[model samples]
Target: MKDTGLVAMTEFLRHPSMVGSAFPATARMVRHMLAPIDWDNVRTAVEYGPGSGRFTFAMLARMRPDARLLAIETGAEFVEKLRASSDDPRLIVAHGSAEDVGRHLTENSLGYADVILSGLPFSTLKQEDAETIMRVTGSALAPSGIFAAYQMRTAVLSLINRQFVDVRQGYEWWNIPPCHLYWASKLRGEGSYEDQIGGSASA
Candidate 1:
């Protein structure tokens, strides 16, 4: 909420190498994809590529007092800003690549998370790196866990859908550039358990 934080966020969003870091998504989009978070089962959440804590704030709002949030970001400046302004005791801001999420969690004793919320630039990632990220993410999920990420189009999602059994689509046309959210959950018996948490079937 500081001026420096806002300025830093703006700079990051405008950077050319990070153009895909469009920083899109309205409050409505945040509410939509993140609303059904199972706070009861979600003892810990691992958020990748949280540039300026937009979705991080939403997650904080929904988490129980005892629950912890681990934010993994590659940018040192962004990580510094987050660690400084993010005063909540439940929040842990780590400076690192999204690909290292598993190691980071393992080092912190948070090996498996109930949910993984990502803001990584899938459209910008190299094909091999993207696949690795997907594989790693899929491997880090708990049996009842869910992975939710937003992309501007379905074209960017083809590789991602290959990993999860139940790949559901959700959208929020209100955001700038709009966005299609991909929700993936580990296969339990048959279908996604999102419905049990009041989540809408991918729309």
Candidate 2:
């Protein structure tokens, strides 16, 4: 990814209809948002709403060479921009809504992924839409998979708590309005899941 890619991303982000029109996530913030991911274990990954490839490019740098990145975006313009910015064989940009995640993977015969990363504006989505997207994302993740997302101030804390055994918050104050990175893992082995939730497995 080049510096100009970020410039174009920032311009698109500033557009009025963009969910993150108020401000784009800075490089520092993107790195912090994705820091908890274990690149070594994530072979097949999906990015929901990759907007300008901020997180997309970061994931590319960290994932294995053979790893595949399926980026789902609804903006036709951003999709073109993402495709033009790079020539990585592992990357595929899908111009569509996050809700199409399951259908896209199914059509490609790509089963549960190792990791699912999202930059979607859940705070702006209707409650039913948000729930559907989360359910689809959860279903698409491997049993031991990790699902990560970022948001500016969300009641999602409660929603995540209900579905995920463990949820950790990573904060980034450098970005305008600042933001919080939420990382949650699908339940794994009995002990591992227990460890993640501090041994409280009531859920």
Candidate 3:
């Protein structure tokens, strides 16, 4: 078996835009990102850009036996590695962009996801692509579902707020570059996001 760390670093060096990070997320970072989720009742979850399946495996460990996790990866190497690494029946690895997440869910016979987690670098993505993803992600969740993402920067915060009415932010300082967490839910609203949540985020 290949060292997952080496594989992740290799991919990140080769495709920095797609892979985002040169290292896997730290245990504390993962816990901080997923701590608020109620894994027992989440029947369906979607993960974006699961480069090394680190968070994927963590979610699988906490999720119910019958729950399903749809992993959408743009990197071919990551997709292949994830499929090769997991024998768990609950994992469904899809090689594609997260823009097609809605279709992926429908194709998999899932109505809506209870948990949508992303590790994609939205700051590196095209402006239109990032906007589309945040918009679709909000619509793809179940009413009470949570959408969480962690980034080295807070550039995606405004984009997330544009889609989700209620958004919460957190920070984990132990990671390599440090990690900024955002947990967003509820749908669109008409107020100013900056006015509702006043703060500055920098990393």
Candidate 4:
């Protein structure tokens, strides 16, 4: 397990575009991002760009016994490492792009995810690719589900806000270079922002 950190750094050096950071996410950062998840009702969870399983372990620890986790990683080395080290039957490490999240869910017999966590570096991704991934993430989550991403810049947040109806921001200074986290949920029957604000003003 000790060498896993070194492995993560090496992967990042080789493929900076795929890996989010030079170091694995700190425990504090992982906890902050996962704080809102209702494990009891989370039937399916998806992790995008899970390099070396930093948050994967955290998610597994909090997940229900019957729930399933699909870890979608594009790097072959990371995918191989996850499969080799993980003993949990509920975890399925798939080697694929984050934009293909919907397809992965359907192929695995898992419907839309209850919660989606991302470690992808949107700042490094092409604009079109980032948009596609965010769009797929928005469409792949359940109506009330949340999408949480730990990013270094606000580019990803901007994309997420465009896709999801509600967006919440968080900050974690404990990480290697610190991070800004974004949590977003699609619009359900909840009234629009204008409607809510207008009603409050009238009252």
Which pairs clash inside model 4?
A: none
Off by over 4 Å in 4: 188-203
Model 2 residue 35 distance off true place after TM-score fit, in angstroms: 1.7
Residue 66 lDDT, candidate 1, scale 0-100: 89
Give the clash count for each candidate.
0, 0, 0, 0
Error of 3 at 120 (Å): 0.4
Model 4 reaches what TM-score against the true structure? 0.90
Residue-level lDDT for 48 in candidate 4: 94
RMSD of each: 3.1, 5.5, 5.0, 6.1
- Candidate 1 C-alpha lDDT tens digits along 29-62: 7777786556666888999877767788889888
lDDT scores in order: 0.73, 0.73, 0.84, 0.83
Q: lDDT by residue for model 2 over 26-68, one digit each (tens)?
A: 8777776666666777778999978777789889998999788
- Whole-model alpha-carbon lDDT for candidate 3: 0.84
**Residue pairs that clash (backbone atoms under 3 angstroms), model 3:** none
Window of ten residues with lowest summed lDDT in model 3 = 194-203
Ranking by lDDT: 3, 4, 1, 2
Lowest summed lDDT across 10 adjacent residues in model 4 is found at 194-203
Compute each candidate's TM-score over C-alphas. 0.85, 0.83, 0.90, 0.90
